[model samples]
Target: MEPGKLLENSELGLRILAGENGLNRKIRNEDVNRPGLALAGFYRNFAHDRLQVFGQGEFAYLLDCGGEVEGRIKDEFFSYEYPALVFTHGNQPPSCFIKKSNETDTPLLQTTLSTHDFILNFNRIITRALAPQTSIHGVLIEVFGLGVLLLGPSGIGKSETALELIERGHRLVADDMVHIRHMGKGELIGESDPMIEHHMELRGIGIVNIKDLFGVGAIRKKVQVDLVVFLEDWKEDKEYDRLGIDEQTMEILDVSIPSITLPLRPGRNIPILVETASMNHRSRRMGFHAARSLSERIHSRISQQITEDAERENPPKKERKKASPKPLMGPV
Candidate 1:
């Protein structure tokens, strides 16, 4: 976003302090750095690309710095290629820092929010604005509180399966081009592209508005992608996991999501399979793994049977009859 728009945005409530000429600066990344160490003459490994944040701690540290120290800090801090400096909790920046900001053509921003709150809000804003994103040809649906992405080749009935899912009361997030963004820290958010949000394309029926056909409750603006289901045309030669003992994963935007593959064939109920997969994934996350538990129980029973058969085959020999010699010796 342009540096000027940061203040004009109502949700952030940032005010421009100085460097009006730098309003056109573009913030290309989502990272926000607090310069607590930078104010203390420590510049090792300093993150110069992020927006610099000066909270109460940093401000206090700056107040304690000697004149030469403060000058050096300001000179070196503004000398880098940072986007801007933000002071939290309505705290006014020192006069010398403001002068340096103006001299270096760096934008100075102030917010009325507390340091913690402003950091939270500013980071959220920047993350959404600059998070890594890509769009894919698939359908996103929320089933049983889980987001399931259906991926397949063209004309493989992804939209048809999604339509059935919608009919089954599950909400559709996006169809036929789901826009996804990785919000860092293992979060992958999916949404419909603006131009095609709430719309779907069926092979024979043409395009349709899901929201219009299925009401507002059948659609969502966005959803976190929890599970990915890849549907493929059934191949007789390819082996598919029947017991689900070996779970699969697919990586998107550096985030590894729990994934499962479904073989599509004639008369196969894709919607039901997707629903069951969603529920099973939720169960796994809740710490109940059905496949592993069943395997363990079956193995235990088989081992017990094997031991019983071995005992029966050998007919464990009985101990020989003992004499009463011990009693007689004691008496003697």
Candidate 2:
């Protein structure tokens, strides 16, 4: 990430106070440092690679220090090649510090946000900016709150199914090309190409903007991919899973995402199937596997039937009748 890119983002509320020459400097670290210890002349463990931040305490400390002491601290701080310096809570750096930053070609930035809020936002922005990314040909949509990626060869009804889903109130994330970023911990975020976002191509019709045709509610900027569905032409001899007892997955960017293959055939509603798959995937995630539950119930019933048959074959012995006492009582 570059300081200029951070400046461009309105959410961060950052502005260049000095050292515009260092706008192109790259920020390799996804973290920021307070540099409190370094300001107090302790630089043993100072992290020079991160963006140095000056919060309320650090700014006040600089203001209270004598001219000579402040100059000494500024010289020592700029000696290291830190990427940039940020002042939070609208605090401004001292003149000597700003001058040193310009002399060292280090970026000096200021934001009105509080220290905690600034750090939180910066971390999120930097993490996404530095995450591993890749692009694939597919349609991404949010069905029942789960992000589903529709995969298949071109002209296999991927766009048409997405259009039907959109008409059914499901939001479309990307069409034709999906740009995916791998946020660590088995998470992948996907978005559409900027030029073609919210637009879909039909076999008969040309490009059409989904948002313009169906309204903004039918579109989404991005979504996390939770399930991958591959659609292929139905084969006469191919066998498909009738009871979803075996789970399947698709690997994207080294992350394993739950996936299923649907054979396309006449009279099969692909959109409805996709919706059901999305819901089923969500249920499985919540620990309720419908297929496994049904299988277990069937096994239990069979075991019970076997026990009943065995008991009937070898019945318990009947107690012998005591006939002599009963006969004497009857005769009297």
Candidate 3:
């Protein structure tokens, strides 16, 4: 696999499904029997009070006030046909068992659902289930202050070029799977996922440890990306750019990264080309655009042609036309 590839995890998911470690809890028949229980999950009933809660799933929230959800759930017992419990604010009591109001000072699940304390606890549980371990596998390249994601068909020598770049002392930000995070101002910060950090897979060879081979100086935890280079097979008929004047860009996460297409050929040293392209890209940002320079040169030659043609004909200058204003009524 190309470096930085994410693998599937079924064991942990299956374990959660197996009801291991109290991950799965069955709702009471009364809870499942309720009308909205199909839509939400379970409902909580309070004793000696007008308070009632309708919540669902492993993550549930209490309704702080009646009619919070207009026409959603009614307050009467007939409106609540599901099972629920009351418990103390912070205590972990039996959620499934029915409770008498005076029996325990602990608030029922319904009473505490809207409290900040409940939301925090519920969030913690939800995040735990969704989190997954990720790994890093390849060098992440950024150019021209624009984030470029260089993705191509596999075995196109992406890592090898990156290795060459590192040998030349350019910093290696991430290898393989880059975890790209979009900041508030639209900046894309890419980092190698921690679990698979500093590792690379080279074709015709096994996994190589980048940190061990190139040392700590070679690897960077994160960096901003600016360009994307997509390397592919060279076609003779394909019109490769003769001049570096056109600006092409690839966008990811709503941020545009300047892009270049590099053709892979036997005699071509791709690393050198990519690096030079990156340097040239940087130069363009400094206002020394090569394509614009060429275009201006062409324009200058065209202007000279017009001057030569006019001189050959030696045409006389025409008189300037004057604007004719409307005649005043008295003058007529």
Candidate 4:
């Protein structure tokens, strides 16, 4: 992110205080730093790569050190080529500090938001802006609170299935094209393209605005992708997963997403299957796996039946041998 971008974003409430010439400086660090120590003549291990933040404590410390001490501190602090300096809670820097910033060509910014709120919003924005992204040709929908991405050939009913899912009260995120981002720690977020957001292209109907037709409740800005569904034409020679015991996954931006392949037939209910798959995915996340549970029960029953059959085939020898030994000990 550049300081100019931060200034352009009105939601962040950041405005230029001084050093407008340094707006193009790149901000490499996602985190901001408090320069209280650097302001107190301690520069060792100073984080000069991040945005320097002057919160209440730092401002108060500067006020305490009047005259020469403050001026020297400001000079030493701005000596490094840090990205920018931000004053939170509407705290304006002193005229000397602004002059120093201008002399050094370091951007100086100010925000009216409290220190905590500004950091929260700033981190959220920076994380998103710097995240790795990719695009996929698929339909994204939110079913049962799980984000589902539909993939397959162009004419494989992906759009139609998404339409049916929308009518069933699920929310449509994207259609035809999806922009995905890798949010660190094994998570993928999916959203629609800016030009085609909340719009779907049906075969005969052309383009339709889902939100305009179904109200705002039927669409979402973005969602975390939890499942991927592939729609393929039915083939007599192909075998699909029926038991669902062997799970499948599709990798998007190096993150593994649970996936399933469904064969399209004349009478198949694709919408319902998608819904069930979404619910099952959620259930599995919560540690309840239906197929695995059933498989375990079947195996246990088969093992018990085998034990009964073995017992019947060869019964334990009765106590007749013990009685013969007792008789021999007593009288032949």
The candidate maximizing lDDT is 2
Clashing pairs in 4: none
Higher TM-score: candidate 2 or 3?
A: 2
Model 3 C-alpha lDDT per residue in residues 146-197, reported as the tens digit of each score: 3445566677788778777778766566667877765435466677768777
Pairwise TM-score winner, candidates 1 and 4: 4
TM-score of 2: 0.93
**C-alpha displacement of 142 in model 2, angstroms?**
1.1
Ranking by lDDT: 2, 4, 1, 3
lDDT of 2 by residue, 161-269 (tens): 9999999999999999999999889989999999998999898899998999999999999999999999999988999989999999998999999999999999999
Candidates in descending TM-score order: 4, 2, 1, 3
Q: Any runs in candidate 3 off by more than 4 Å, and if so which?
A: 1-138, 142-148, 315-332
How well does model 4 score by local distance difference test?
A: 0.91
**Higher-lDDT candidate of 1 and 2:** 2
Cα error, candidate 3, residue 139 (Å):
4.0
Q: What is the TM-score of each candidate against the true structure?
A: 0.80, 0.93, 0.53, 0.93
lDDT digits (tens) for residues 1-332 of candidate 4: 89999988777799998999999999888989998888888899999999988899988887788898977986687789978999999998888789988998889999999999889989988888888999999999999999999999999999999999999999999999999988799888899999999899999889999999999999999999999999999999998889999999998888889999999999999999999999999999999999999999999999999999999999888875554344535655
